[model samples]
Target: MFSSKSERLFTGMIAAALAVSAVTPVVSVEAKQSEKVTYQAKKQETIEILAPTSPLVFKQGEKLKGKDRILNVKIDGKVKKQPVRWSNLTTSTIGEFTATATYSHKGQTVTLDVPYTVEGYELAIMHTNDTHASLDNAPKRATAVNQLREENANRLLIDAGDVFSGSLYFNKFKGQADLTLMNYMQYDLMVPGNHEFDLGTEAGHPEFAEFIQNAEFPFVSSNVDYSGDQYLNALYSEDLTHKPVDGKLYEGVIKTIDGKKVGFFGLTTEDTANIASPGPIQFQHYIDEAEKAVKSFKQRGVDQIVAVSHLGFDDNPAVDNDLELAKRVEGIDVIIGGHSHSRLNEPVVVADGAEPTVIVQAYQYGDFLGTLDVVFDQNGKIVSHQGKLIDVKTYAADPTAVSLLAPFAQEIESIRNAEIGAEATAAFDNPRDAGDVTKPSVRKNETALGNLITDGMLDRAKQMDGEVVAAIQNAGGIRAPINAGPITTGEVLTTLPFGNTLAVMTLDGSELLSALERSVSVYPIESGGFLHMSGMKVEFDSSKPANSRIVKAQVLKDGQYVDVVPTETYKIATNYFAAKGGDNYLEFKKAYEEGRVNDLGIIDWEIMRDYLVKLQTVTPSVEGRILDVK
Candidate 1:
């Protein structure tokens, strides 16, 4: 009876299984009758649609069809192929295009809008450098910036800094005027030049710190170490950030432009340590810092890099410059440079690395606005570029900027128009030999202006220290020209805008000789360290080597020139910048460190103004004070 029951139960179970199998296929067919239902069932809450990476390039006259319209649709990490149709997909023109791609399966559809270029992605950059606080043309620069920004959607405006000293505006407003205009123009980024630190030693960079605090844009400083400075340390960040805050400083920043990532970092010249009063702030090796920046950006998946560099275009190779930085380091795409006041009308291409790097600079003052249009492929490599300098004078002043500058201008006008009870018979031109090498440059050769400046410094120093025998001024400290007319306080302040204090140093004849050697080290090539003398005569041979170039050094004692004795001590007057070892004056630095230097606590412009008043009518001339025998 148990065996019979088991056989019956097994037969019944087989019949039930066969009945279910027959209905299962029919039910499956019915469920898949609508393809939309099947797709929805496979669709996940999270879907990733992968398209070709941007900077997508298409050849001229190419059609957007076939495999180009395909996308990888990923659901739950499983990818499947899907065909897409594009709207407004025209490739006949060579420019950027925005288009939408639609994917449809049965009754289900999804869409995505993307931007691509026909040939390559075009990026427009507007840059300025070494503005030197010449805010008179700020309105015109604003006009140019506004027009350029309006012309292109992909654009950036940047500055390679020195917006501190040079004019009455900086003397009175202390960079606030420039900052106001820079804010109006909407600058993207900036790097500090040497002159930005001019007030560090005297005022501890109070105005500069305020300038940074009030700026509406961010500052990048990859090689400059602000940690040593109490004021700047609080505002500086060593990390690379994707989201940068205005009125702050960073080592590096990542910017997103049209779904592409671009990296920017700042590099101030290392010469700042010797040339400017950075106080306790320090500078690092540019190459090392630059390499680290590039690597950090690369690790963050940023390929396009720009360096807002205060290093000169082709300055002293022994120190640091943009050209050297580009060659020594890799992965730098563009360099917007300043310092040395290079006017690069066209972009300079350096192709020493795997990819080419482009360098550009606007000349000193607010005269020109540099513009560069660079094209990049999908790989973020610069393939083609065009660069040019737009004369800011050509553009009419922006009315908005003008209105913003009105109050500052009114105050500056009153101060600049005040007469100093002096007149010049001839225009005291401050010439530079950058374009014409044969011409005499105030930086490379002696000038009447230099003489007058040093004479004033000597007069002031002698009043304080009777034993002061001579005075000297660095060529870089001499800024603008004096017109042939009534001398105004503005002109004097503009010419000597650094606010340097008069200093007297007791140095032996040998030490003075060493300072002279350092001054003429780069003889014919204009050097900021070049010395302009008063109460002294120096004759050097240009053909001879730098250290031993001085043939004869004489000091005026009681209206007579006497040969300098190597062991004899002589009291010299010069600006505190020079006495403190500025412009690489190591011997003077040693004297200062040894307490042989006394700062007179008087402003340089004040000395010049007072001396001008002393001489009501002056006719200063270059009188063979400095001669090159070669």
Candidate 2:
């Protein structure tokens, strides 16, 4: 009976102490950029801080007594100011005390009670990048996204950009259908990926704006300037919110759940400037924009920051990849990344200040959804993180989303099921097979389809500019080759799924030399230094140093060897993907940015299709165009 009475008294004291602490006055906070205050408590308790909301915590059975001394302020983890008010806190039960904050201004005070438990709030991030309009339910990815939403109602669905452009579905539906699908999936937000601007016509923007206005969630971006771009301006105007960090306007967003604040900013790779037709709009530096947005969010009392970036995961820190971004930017909590279409079987944790930021991505074609579950403490620090690539194949499709896509699926089925091409043998098998080009009929090093693509680009470039010299085709881009028989429109679409236009760039001999060097550097590395050429003979020694392995690179002009010098410039023909260096060719990106000019009127696939039908036969054979040997 005595022990029970003692327990009751102890519990009552704790309750009284907490009530008093909740009613205490909020400190007048004047925060600067990169600076944070510490409210040290005499006890230990877990608390959470959410966005657009204020919360508080305090030591149990303790009261503010005696004079208060200002504690120190931390800036970038170092002591900056030494003047935070400290009160003497004590617990009658002899346990450590915890502290929280209250917000009070002009005598209008509100109290927030902290959750005094060990577990923090779980933030589930469902991210997709480079969807490229793979919206059909039968294909797999569309079904996977919907399943995740049903399985995890608390899920935050985000797209890392490039949601449109690529598949025949985009061209047939003009993105309206894709937007509807994303709406059904209930995407929390999406950033502008490079390919979203596939159509060179400006009229597409206004329609896009209308789509956003009706979207279930917002589209977030920090660096893309839509001020003068009337089409983009119309679409994202209302959703635009300026942050406090910099006076610059941003298309980023902040969302809250359970008293916890989370901020999301979007960034598309600057390389988009050269690849896609951004017209008059300018893309800001990725690092600069990210830094400003993070600072602005922190100023708004939002410490959990994520960047839905379209930048690919680069192994090198110098290039634009998610891994490089994590290392370069310190405060980003997580990066839902895309554009490289990397299948990161696992997530990579990058250290950000006192915590680690998670970087993740799902491979393209709706095969997977990247999930990052993060838990944060009261002080806005991440306590624990769990991430994985959830394969879409494992989940049962939601009947609702499937029903929503029924009409679109029917339309696609009419085309896919209609036989366009017949193959003598399976033309292409996936990468899992040995010695297989992407298609079964074509070998990797050389293929009829690859030759046909290179020839088509060269044929079109000659008509556009008399100076056209050489063309190159990436092995990965050619999805499949003809099986020596009848061909149909559907077969062609499957082979060249993306609506990539022809782009001709003038490259100086020096730049072309560097490109050739890169093409041959890792010759022995599978899928490394292979090239399909139309106007050049490239020979390399595999045993040579990586950076200087190109033994010989010569361009033919008028059926004779041209006296090419490093200073001389020549016109080159290729698709936009290579110009932007989609496959880790930084030199190509650099060339497109500084030297290549876009002639948007040209279309490569159309030309290739026309050329193939005219020839009535395509027997591609490697004719020592690119020779590499140890």
Candidate 3:
């Protein structure tokens, strides 16, 4: 599924694994006689090509999706030690071929059999996903893209999206930093990720729709309906699939790759509604729209189809993931996906039917670029495939990329570098307060980082708007840990990279209790909805059942902790995402429905910065704010 630069990865007991694998047949035979089955080793080798010595195999033909024809190398029992060095095991046509690898390490001579069965052939496609406005990584990604372009002149470069709202780069320039670098890479196409609408989705300040208008390439989306908003429609006019809310977004573009037509369309995730404010824009069912797009492309005589998707992928096909899409949608050849940050070393081929759907997704934050080598048979059905997730950090920052980003970098450096506060000798965990300082997890249980974030949110709400009682920050919004030195704005930005705006809402004490119950439902299992609250204390028992986990909760009022009255309404401030029912906060959603929510334009990180600045020196330690009752 994933090919990488030749490096020995200490994954598992490699020698012991091979020994058991060699005995599988005997075990199986004995099992049949005994009427019992033994477990098989799921461990895989970490062997890679040390150099670019391997030559291309198979001829280019009609292209689309199918199972990955993997070339598995078999180790002979006669050979005990094998060298790491291996070279060209090329096949111009379909057949079984043998290659040799010989190497010596630490006085051990090694020999192994490198076997190849040519079942398919190669399309060069380069893609980025969940870039998340990591400015430093963007240039490196650009460098990697350049290298990939040089290697394959006919390669297709694209982004799966979420190229917005993270780090100081986004905090300073919105998303221009990522856009400039992506434009520098000369991406052929891109889709809008959920974070693109984080700035409240109105046709107002921090408008991604307007910013997208300046992009060099087309931004396509077949499912998200922008027809309700005239501004969104105009700003995203180039998004071929925009105006028409039909399952088939009339924007599928067919490109001539080696004189073969390759169709590409975009599909945003359905979860965007729950996670972001898309204003008048609405997302359609991805599976339905994706199928319709594929049918449309097939009707247009497009042999190959690529879906640039932002719908998150999961190991479970039952969820609305790329794997699910691949299982249901047979015609889509390749799906470049984002959202959920699945790092696949090899492409996932779902062989649910006659044709397998190939799914590829790189890890988040532009650290790696996904490169899939898909081989098609004579009829254009995918016969075999190989995938490589290229590490962008390996490449140097291109000068052109550096120059293009200079202005934005300059604008941010002064403010971001300013010293905000200092820790008193102890290094604060990036809020990964999972009881283990080394591991750093805030999603479950209580955390010092969550406490600090809630305190900041509470302070900001009180300062910006009146009648704000308490604040809660979701663990997912905390991005980085602060070191035990002078904490700068840059560190704060990284720590709270989402730049979530504050939203205040009034909910009855019973509703608040319900929200807290939902927050701790997955306690100890690390749910992002885990709430860290200011001006409140939560004492829950995880041993209890969900929705009834909270035993006792108290809200701070007039410098006193009082029992939450079910009939009493309390003003609560939280990040806008959670205010709009993100993290399944149905109570908050209910309040939004009743028009009890007010979203202020104040940025979250700035609020934290102000809080830290007011303190002059901050040493946020875990207090008994949230308790887990045994």
Q: Where in model 1 is the C-alpha error above 4 Å? A: 1-117, 202-204, 419-450, 454-487, 491-630
Best-fitting candidate, measured by lDDT?
Answer: 1
362-422 in candidate 1: lDDT tens per residue?
9878789999998776567898999999999988999999999999999988988898899
Off by over 4 Å in 2: 1-117, 137-151, 200-204, 238-250, 315-321, 352-355, 413-441, 444-448, 457-469, 474-487, 496-531, 538-553, 557-559, 562-630
Q: Model 3 over residues 485-556: C-alpha lDDT tens digits?
A: 788888887888775667788899899999999888876777778888898988998789999888899988
Top-scoring candidate (TM-score): 2
Clashing pairs in 1: none
Alpha carbon deviation, residue 154, candidate 2 (Å): 1.4
How accurate locally is residue 7 in candidate 3, as Cα lDDT from 0 to 100? 28
**Residue-level lDDT tens digits of model 2 in 241-271:** 5331221224677777545778888887777
Q: Which ten residues in a row are the worst by lDDT in model 3?
A: 25-34
